[model samples]
Target: MSSTLPVLHVGFHKCGSTTLQAALFGRHPQIDYLGEPREEPRSTEAIRLVRDSCYVEERKRIRFDPERSRALWQEALSDVAPGLVPVFSKESLTQPEFYAAPDDPNLPERLRAVVGPARIVIVTRHQIRLIESLYLFHAKGVHVEPAQQWLDARQEEMHQYRFHTVAQSFVAAFGRDNVAIFPFEDMKTDAKSFARRICDFIGVDSQHGADLIAGERRNQRVSQRYLAYSKIRKAFGLYIPIGRMMPEAMRRSFNEFVAGGREARIELPATFVAKMEDYFRDDNRKLARDWGIPVEKYGYPV
Candidate 1:
């Protein structure tokens, strides 16, 4: 622990977070990045604590110990070089509950306590696309919920996707100058510039790792066969890890028979998108007016 930490990239998921973590931050020679286990090569105890602690289980919010988190962070910083700026990135930091008006907003405050006023970076995308992509992301796993129900549940959490609200909360916690927001659309359009901008903001060398993060679209494609198989698993009340038990040969044959190689054309209904646009119009208008960002050009509702 030589100096105060610099940046915290608290994510609004379904953004290019995985690619940024795996390719840009993970590979950057100067930045000392810490986050999830598999996504980060240098998964320290501090990150595990952050990821494990903040969540709701069985209608109860899990507690996060600021002192313990700081202690673990101190221990984790032992390996970092004196001059390197330590960056903590976890896309799920602003957990789903934070968006609800009545819920206690402890994550940002807890983070302030643990790290003490660091720069906060929020990377988000268009609301309709964000929700649609999120549904597909869950479809990859044991999630068998009907897409309509899943999307409808999330539509209620409009504050989460408002982008400006979440950004302003961090700005409230950590001073105005410390918060920066960017669109994931920029990364998709120009990977090099997008990576460079973030690297520059974080005070790291941007020239080194831009190309590594190009063209990364993670888990947006849903498999039709898997959707059917997953529903059947749900029908039988099997929520456990039963996929491993299926014989590899049988799995391969089933995939061939079902033509699971083809990506399913899953899409959100136009009415849902229109509702989201109408809901977020005012918020997006405010975001553009305050931030001077051309959100409309990137398909955001203005």
Candidate 2:
């Protein structure tokens, strides 16, 4: 309605959402990044409207209020200066469970209602590695659970990696011509190329994107040593005291000493890897063939 083309980066998290939010999208002069990244803008009302409306079931069963959500969106849109690309970014949008494999069952219709038709951007990672990284991610949380327990096969997180299913939703919700999909591997291989593609999609200058992404990775993986340390600390009820009881320098030194040297990475079992391969192969292949993605170049499940 406002003649401003909105870009929605519906992050299937563990992809490059953080970097894109904090660096690529957030820093671009021509882009108006709204609502949430790894940074403070996270708790804003723009996207919380969608999150609250879409995920909250109790209200839905009673009586969903679409106008309330629309008001929040309209308010956010009012502040956007003309000629700047508006980007609503939140990786958790795709994963309603906050941080898990199973994506939101419903396409984000409430958000779509705000901006009649908007361009969508989706980024996906290799299933096996994505799951592995997720395990490592959760392991560092205050309560570290066993890898298997953290994974919780019952969640069927692997299915979320079927990239096509996720991407196609955006394609359907926004037009086929409006949805852009990028493989996470590309960012790993050529950050510049990846930056250019996204910048191109959002109709912004690509040059600045390159400079913004230099060594910018929020939520860097914790060291493998943290897995056991987190659990032991949780067991001892040490999730408090605000890191006091010792001098600042001594605490910093002690923490550095305990952290493992290598980045923490969960090693998936062979059987699990095989299962992931079987599950994602056809989906990935179809996605590549249809979307013209050079997925094989990255040795993805396909």
Candidate 3:
């Protein structure tokens, strides 16, 4: 409450980041939203910098240049919100190599310069479902291989990523008191309370955007058929506007077919699930100890 606010929603993406951003940051009267929806190679510029110069050679070069990225990020915020507290949401902020060395001379200082004394909110999901949704999301565009195949081939790479390291980085930069960790599942069910917590964090009143939260998760499901259809449409020029021209019943049938065929239970197979769980176990444990976030809140037994 002492000064202006900036809350960075460094995401463990596909954890309803879109819905939460839509309701809280996207439409909030007090918050300004940044970043492009459906932007791939998310935080592309920042990732490139991290990969090329900052990261070790053994590490994959899939990161951005944080300094330039945040400069542009802040510029985007200045353009959009003018005088308000800026709320930036980007899933790429959780990248392990990027966050691991917060004490490093270069990156952390750049982060501190852009969003001074910012409150960092990290939204995470159960690992099993999170990775699965991510696989589907990748299928939508980011990947050519099927979900299972990506898992099989990239298991070590995926598992080696210590996403929870971002929590430590934020705590190191902004202090533990400024960090708010929440389960995306809970946020989906009780957005008002979640929003209130965030409002309190940013020193904004809940009434600033309480009414706008009503339709938060309206687009929660996408059927596999629709995803496939979308890919076909993209190839053949059957766009959404064209789909809108079709009879409503026909569109509904198409959507339903995708939902029926593509939707899978969030549960993953045992070995695949175990690999992810074992990989993050220590990182999550360290996060809990450092930040007092309950290990149980992570949706897997520690």
Instruction: Assess the local accuracy of residue 48 in candidate 3 as a C-alpha lDDT between 0 and 100.
Output: 37
Looking at model 2, the pairs that clash are: 36-42
**Scored by Cα lDDT, where does model 1 land?**
0.71
For all predicted structures, in order, the TM-scores are 0.79, 0.85, 0.70
Give per-residue CA lDDT, model 2, range 1-302, as digits (tens).
Answer: 23568888888778978888888887899888884643224325556655655543454422335576567667767777888888888776776342233334344555566566788898988777778788877666677676666656434545667778777666666778898888888888888888888998888888788777766777667776666577677889788633467799988876786574887766766776787798889888987889988778877878
- Error in Å for residue 218 of model 3: 5.4
The lDDT of each candidate is: 0.71, 0.72, 0.60
Badly placed stretches (over 4 Å) of model 1 are: 1-4, 38-59, 62-64, 102-105, 215-220, 223-264
Q: What does each candidate score in C-alpha RMSD?
A: 4.2, 3.5, 5.7
- CA RMSD (A), model 3: 5.7
C-alpha-based local distance difference test score of model 2: 0.72
Tens-digit lDDT string for candidate 1 (1-302) = 43645688888787877778777777777777776434434335555455456544435555666677787666666777777877777876766654444133556666777777688888978887787677766776765577778877765565677788777777777878888888888888888888888877877777775766666555345667766666677688788635457799986776665546666556777787788789888888877998766788998987
Model 3, 1-302: lDDT tens digits are 22366677767667767776777777766665554363323233443343344343445544444567656545544454445666667765564444334334334345665456777777766666677776666655633465567778755446423545655556777787888787676666677776676677776667665556655674465575656665676677544534577799997875566667646433456787776778778877765776565667547535
On a 0 to 1 TM-score scale, where does candidate 3 land against the true structure? 0.70
Best by TM-score: 2
Q: After superposition, how far is residue 51 of candidate 1 from its true place, in Å?
A: 7.9
